[model samples]
Target: GESVGLHLPTLSVQEGDNSIINCAYSNSASDYFIWYKQESGKGPQFIIDIRSNMDKRQGQRVTVLLNKTVKHLSLQIAATQPGDSAVYFCAENIAGRGGADGLTFGKGTHLIIQP
Candidate 1:
């Protein structure tokens, strides 16, 4: 069963430092994972994604790590800036199931940047 309703986690980091956000999922059958960043009063934006076959994937300044063994996922942001401050979410997509239903999202994590 999925989570009914839950609050997002919170993470605080200093400017220019690296930020790491973690998430845990309950579905072991899921094979696709994505990370999104959402700013205030805005929609969530795509950051990075990884498939179950891959343990890690990297983008420009963002990296996503997937550990199916423990049903864990994480996002790493390098050289964090004030602009990077936002709420991050991890979503899981069950292979061949969510064709039209879409992905299931985690609560999310608030990333705050300190000057």
Candidate 2:
């Protein structure tokens, strides 16, 4: 089962810093993974994705590192900013006879920023 409960939902940060959000997953058979960022009352935006065959993947200012051995994934922000304050979620998509499908999202981590 996935973790879902009344957990703290805000993270405070300075204008320029690094932020790391964490999520715990339930299913292990899931292979495809994606990290998404969602602002206040907005839809989730795709940041990056990684497959089971890959260990690490990088984007413009973000990097996604996957640890298949422990079924854990992390997203690293180069320089955190005010706009970077948002909720991040790690989704797992299991590929099987059905082909590619929708993602099962883990509980998100809220990122807050301070001036």
Q: What is the C-alpha lDDT profile of model 2 across 14-55, one tens digit per residue?
A: 778876665555567777888889998999998988888898
The lDDT leader among the candidates is 1
Clashing pairs in 2: none
Candidate 1 minimal-lDDT segment of 10 residues = 1-10
TM-score of each: 0.89, 0.84
What stretches of model 2 exceed 4 Å from their correct place?
3-8, 96-100
Question: Candidate 1's error at 17, in angstroms?
Answer: 0.7
What would the per-residue lDDT of candidate 1 be over residues 41-81, giving only the tens digit for each residue?
99979888888999999999888888889788889999999
Q: Clashing residue pairs in candidate 1, if any?
A: none
* CA lDDT, every model vs. true structure: 0.83, 0.75
